[model samples]
Target: MGSQSARNIEVLNQNIAELNGDINVSFEFFPPTSEAMENTLWQSIDHLKKLKPKFVSVTYGANSGTRDRTHGVIKDIKERTGLIAAPHLTCIDASKDELKQIALDYWNSGIKHIVALRGDIPEGGDRPHMYAADLVELLKSQASFDVSVAAYPEVHPEAKTAQADLLALKAKMDAGADRAITQFFFDIESYLRFRDRCAAIGIDQEVVPGILPVSNYKTLVKFSKLCNVKVPNWMHKMYEGTDDDPTTRNLIGASIAMDMVKVLGEEGVKDFHFYTLNRSELSYAICHTLGIRP
Candidate 1:
């Protein structure tokens, strides 16, 4: 028994070492909705800061107050932690002038990177930036910001077809967007297929895979549905009996993320974007498993 355990540990160490630190990682954080959440958000930031991520982004919902919170958090991350903070800007319920001014403000505030998007319309809100391609064009006209647009491995929910979605991405790239961060996906083959399709169609840009650590099956299911992500049956089976066991749930979550990234690394993928929902333990475990150290 002791010999078998030792051999398993050695094999695990070998697999970890095979994934060198050639990877560039970034994180996405949502703006905190309340004071306590704000505290938790910053705590998670502090916990993960040592990883020296490529950049940290704050999500902006389609609302005025939430927009303000996004900007505030972006500046706070830059000032307090000295990390590269990218603010997500949406052309939702705002005029072209409003969006341009916001872009100017971000540029003036020493923000060089922006994630431009035509955000989801809020309940009863209008969508002024009808397409993310248009938002990318607008950002380029305003300033030479490093802009990233969102990509969907599974066709975007609103897309007419997969080919149409690829054309939209090409338009964004042509309009001077630098890269794309994908919506989180569980299936590795789905992303690889998307990559191949992008390459065949002449879309030249990095499509960083978005990784979501699933600490709670219920929350994961809800968000995945909102984003049009398919939850595989294997995942459902894995979380079957952990409804009340957070400790076990967290372990399973980390294990899933670890397996996903390891396979990605084998495929020569070196960039990762994590949708960290103001938590660090699962993300930390996965990153550490991939040989990413403080």
Candidate 2:
């Protein structure tokens, strides 16, 4: 038993040593609606910034008020941190001219990166759609912005077929997207297969894996269903009976995220994007374990 324990420690040390200083990370935040939430968001930012992420992005919402809030958050992030702050722009309910003007405004404000997406289709509101590819084209035409688009490893929920989804991603890249950040995924093999397919289809751009460290299992399940992401049964089993124990749940969450990062790093994936739900403790712990330090 003593020899086995010593061997486990040695193996763990080797893994940590291999991962140290070999990975790059980025974070995503959403616009906060209330003062308390705003404080929490900034606090999270302050904590994560120590790791020196490649960039930070604020997610865009569907309404005009949410759009304005996104811009505000972007501007504040830039002003406060002097970091590369990207705003997510979805071509869902706006005119081409309006999007063009918004792109121009962002460029003039010293913002250089944009996460372009085709946002969710509004309920019972069928409008002429401008796809993410269209938005990427519009942004590139308006300014020399570094555009990032979304990718799905398990396929998009609204996609007609997996092939069609791959073609859609290819179209976004063909439209001048610099890279693609995948939807948060749990199955490493699924993401690996998706990368192989992207390479096969001539998507030469880097598809950064998006990692959402599970904090609340219930919330993750609800969102996963909407996004058509399959949460593996083992994950459900791990979180079972931990609903009343946030401390235990957080520990499990960090361990799971750490395991995923270790595997991805071993697979030669250098860049990772973390979906930080405006809280930092779990992500901070995971990054620390990955040897990302202040």
Candidate 3:
């Protein structure tokens, strides 16, 4: 048994050596809604900043207050961390003129990267007048912004067909998007197939996989359903009966994430975007396993 365990360890070390610290990572954060949460967010940032991510992005919302908070967080990240901070811009509850103005403001403030998205329509609200592709064009016309748009490996919930979804992504890329950061996913095979389809359709832009380290299983499931992301039966069973033990859940989450990263890295994926959910331990551990260090 001891010899077998040593052999397994030797293989793992070989895989890490092959990865060769060539992986680049980025983190995503959401604006904190309360003082306590804000503190936690900053703590996580300080802890993970040592890893020196390529860029960090903050999610956006449709409301005015949330919009202000998003802007504040983006600027603060830039000022405090000296990291490239990207703010998410969505074409919902806003006009083209307004978005152009916002883009101009971001440019003037020295913010160069933007994550262009078509935000979720509010409950009972009117459908968006513009889409992500249009927003990408608008931003490009206003300034030379490094724009990143969203991609869905599992097919967007509203898309009528997988082909339509791929075309949507193509439109965004054609509109001068620098790259497409995918929605969080667990199914490694799904992402691999999606990449193949993109290449088949002549999409030359890079598509970075979004990795969500599950901190809370129940919360993940709820959000997954809303986003049309599937939680495989194995994952469901893995988390079953561990509701009260966060330590165990976190260990399991880290193991799954490390496994995913190992497989994806072997497939020549050099970039990973982590949806950190304002926590650092799980992501930090996973990065360490990938040979990323301070």
Candidate 4:
């Protein structure tokens, strides 16, 4: 048998080789809420554009009130930055005609990609009503643009079971979604298991893993709970009592993200979608760790 040291060196060399190639990456950003926020978003976009992402997505607000602003930002990004702008379209608060009109507008404006979603209901609101109950139906109704749907590796908060969630994902792909982007998860095992389950079900579209570099542990914990993503106890211990140490927290966050991506990369993931959360530094640092120099 080969020595363990030799095998380890071989694996390390393989990872280095994989990093040398062009790895497709995309970023997700929310539409700015104010003038200053708008400035920061644009600056982040400008800085990250040099990395040549496959495309960048701008998120829509829960109620669709930011529709105009989202459109404006997507249009500006396409016109000004030479980046493919994929605006998120949701079915939580829009009628069929309104959704179709928005799709038509995007098509007319030279935008071709859309991240179709069943957006979360506004806080403490009644059941959401719209043309599509979920993203699959929405994708089926709007056939003009290339559509992407959400996938949940750790299972959606509202989903009763992982099987049910996977079935929902299959329905989206069956409805002609072009790709699936997952919600952020810390565990690579969860992602790998989800991918295997998808393959078993014969849903074969690209499912890009969403990466979120933890900037604020407290905020991440809150969001993770809301979204049903399990925050491992080990993760908490890693950042335990680092609340006041911003510098140490960020360094630990970056290292954790790098380790996560490296493990996923080893599992044959070539594409990644980062939830930038409107900040560029942590994501930028993670990219650097992956040997992605812009």
Candidate 5:
């Protein structure tokens, strides 16, 4: 039994090494609000660009509040950096004409890729207006851009059921979405199960797993609650009392991410999307662990 356990660990480690060598990665960033944050964001961007990511995405704020800034940042990145800039577009608090104009603007600006989403309601709102209805509707309307829609490995927060969510994803693919980026998940099993379910339903688009390097456990827990992502009890326990130990927390976070990626690689996933949260260390360390060099 001991020998078998040791062999299993060896196999897992071997898979991790191989994945680190061959995996392709992308990153997501949000438009900065303040001058200080803007500086920090640029610094993070500069650092991660050294890894030569497949592309870098800038997220739009809820209700299109930061639409202008998002576009500006994306344009600047395309002009100044070597990374492919993909700005997120959402179907919330915007009319069809507005959404179309945004898509057209991106296309005209040489931004070919878009991460389309049904953004959450803004704060203090009783209910969202569903302006664009959902992502599939937006995808169907926007014919020029290569669209990537969101997927929930554990199911979307407002979804009726997991099967319904998968069907919705299939609909989005049918509506001309090129790919799907899943919400961040802790366990590899969640993603694997979701992928299998997608396969069973004949949804063939590439579903890139979203990797979030934990910078703050408390913050992550709060965000997860808002997004309806389950944070495993074991995960909380792992970081239970490490609040004061930034170094150890970051090390555990990187290890957890590397192990998750290794498991996903075993399941035949070759691409990953890191939700950088405007920071670089944890994401950088995880990439380094995967053999991505600066």
Candidate 6:
């Protein structure tokens, strides 16, 4: 009887630890391409805004017009929801002067945070900024904005070696990036090991884990290939029979993300960044399960 009581107490402790609300979360969204997508984006934002994410970011695509559209959405998020809006700035085809102008424009428009990235190079385009470190430097030169840069637990697809990838991340941090948001990864140890390596290298800035809830396995697999993120075999096995069931897939996705949060929280990872893809339900459910309340 005493042993049974002790076991119940231990279980209660574990539950409390999981629901302690020590976690902070931010979300990411892409700029809408059409008016219908635009409306959907806002609706998702409205649903998730009450959760009080630390900040929200809008991504920039390769096109020139997409930049302004990203800005408008970010501005609206900031003005309407009063949440900190971060605009992703990619230095791909633009010259240094042009990139600097864009940074200044964001600053002038009362937007203060930027996610500096060496974005995807357009088809047959040259590398103008060369690296994300360059973009980080350029953004810092323009203003004292809170800058975030990308990190990879799995080495970047273009990186020649693991050491080279870590060095690139160090360079961005050295260039005054305030935080590093890692690319979404399924292997939990990938993040834990990356954090250890960053600590070993003395990159002391905040390293936030990026969590992505799988909405569609097929789409996720395609994106994982493009982003160099690996989907583990066990995960594939879990989603094997959910191809035709969106509801079951979402439940599975939320369960996967919640497990990650519980493990990561126990490991002392205090913050998370969600790649929302402008969809709310899965992300919202993950946060809700994490004890992140409205």
What is candidate 1's lDDT per residue for 1-294, written digit by digit as tens? 699987866765576687667788999999998899999899999989999999999997788899999999999999999999999888866888998899999999999899988888666655444678888888889889999999999989978998999898888888899999999999999999998998898887898999999988998899888878999999999999999999999999888888888777767688999989988888877888788899
TM-score for candidate 1, residues paired by index: 0.93
* TM-score of each model, paired residue for residue: 0.93, 0.95, 0.95, 0.91, 0.92, 0.93
Q: Is candidate 3 or candidate 6 better by lDDT?
A: 3
The predictions' CA RMSDs to the true structure, in order, are 3.0, 2.1, 2.0, 2.7, 2.3, 2.9
Q: Write the per-residue lDDT of candidate 3 for residues 184-212, one digit (tens) a residue.
A: 99999999999999999989888999999
The whole-model lDDT of each prediction reads 0.88, 0.92, 0.92, 0.84, 0.84, 0.88
Model 5 bad stretches (over 4 Å): 122-143
* Cα lDDT of model 6 by residue, 1-294, tens digit: 699987865664486366556778999999998999888899999999999888999998877899889988988998999998999888876888888888888899889999988888777776564688988888888889999999999989989999999999999999899999999999999999999999999999989999999988999999899888989999999999898999999999998998887777767788999999899999998888678888
* Residue-wise C-alpha lDDT for candidate 2, range 224-259, written one tens digit per residue: 999989999999999999989999999899888988
Model 5 residue 91 CA deviation (Å) reads 1.7
Q: Which pairs clash (backbone N, Cα, C closer than 3 Å) in model 4?
A: none
lDDT of 4 by residue, 1-294 (tens): 569977865675479467765578899999999999988998899988888888999998866568788899999999999999999888878877788788878888889889988787777877767522255465456656678789999998988899988998897888788889999999889999999999999999999999988868999999898898988889999999999999988888888888788778777888889999887888887777666787
Candidate 4 residue 194 Cα shift, in angstroms, is 0.8
Model with the higher lDDT, candidate 3 or 4: 3
List the candidate 6 regions with Cα displacement exceeding 4 Å: 1-19
Better of 2 and 4 by TM-score: 2
Off by over 4 Å in 4: 1-14, 123-143
Q: In terms of lDDT, which candidate is stronger, 1 or 5?
A: 1
Candidate 3 residue 278 Cα shift, in angstroms, is 0.7
Clashes of each: 0, 0, 0, 0, 1, 0
Check candidate 2 and list the clashing pairs. Answer: none
Clashes of 4: 0
